[model samples]
Target: MEWHQPPAALVRTMNVVLRGVLPSPLGRGVGEFMLLAFTGRRTGQRYRVPVTAHRVAGDLCALTPAGWRLNFRGGADVDVTLAGRTTPMRGVLVEDRAEVARIYLDRMTELGMRRAARMIGLKFPLGRLPALDEVAELARREHFGVVRLSVRT
Candidate 1:
């Protein structure tokens, strides 16, 4: 499917959410999640995509499909807003595929398969989690991207 480019205004709104409202409510429901604002390098438009957040080692990280979409995989930087603070995060793009796998496994389990799967954008009514190894493989190859945002204290 062709990628959808979010308008400039939407990007601004997302910036407000990620950099302004996500940190304090760190582990809340995904709905409370403000979309991780990303931009299309070629189109220069903004896209607001809601993503699960994790504050690890004092920095916040955002995850996306490895090979599933364009708005993120094709983008270079990510913007996260939390608690009224906005920060333009440069993309580090996890280079270690294994690390990606491990991280995804942790995230999925943290969210809970039957409960948080839907929130994370996974649709599996069967309520079964793919084998951990299988999930890792998909995470490694399936258009995934990770952008780490630094918290401005």
Candidate 2:
């Protein structure tokens, strides 16, 4: 899917809410942005899921692991909410390993997933997930997938 830039006003609001309220008032961890809400393809109901965001060639991109396939795969017309505003988004499934890794690694490193997981009483599956070289292979063997959201301007 093509990428769409978020409006300047929305970015400003996100900086304030994400940096201000989310961390202090809500006591949430930092480096977290993008809350995606979509109508389940099967259920036709709303479901909201939080994701880490990154700037990929000037457009915001959300990364997802194979674990999220249950919620993201085949989903369409996703609604992305940042700060307090909601925007219409088109969901496109992505399966390229290098591309997926580029964004996934960026998110994990930025968010310090290993450390954050510890804080949240979760364990990191050190190397259990597919290795970089085997990403594409694993994706094909299993059902690895991601849904990229392109917000409509």
> Which candidate achieves the best lDDT against the true structure?
1
Candidate 2, residues 8-49: lDDT per residue as tens digits?
697567655554443243523344466666776667777656
Which segments of candidate 1 are over 4 A away from where they belong? Answer: 1-31, 37-49, 56-58, 66-78, 123-128
Error of model 2, residue 19, in angstroms? 16
> After superposition on all CA atoms, what RMSD does each candidate show versus the true structure?
7.2, 10.6
Worst 10 residues of 2 by lDDT: 115-124
lDDT of each: 0.55, 0.52
Residue by residue across 1-153, what tens digits does model 1's lDDT show?
111235669756765665444545652333345445667666887765555566544656666663323444423666665443446765455656777666666666777775445434554544566666876666655555555555333
**Error at 137, model 2, angstroms:** 7.3
Best by TM-score: 1
Off by over 4 Å in 2: 1-31, 66-75, 106-145
Candidate 1 lDDT score relative to the true structure: 0.55
How do the predictions measure up, each by TM-score?
0.56, 0.51
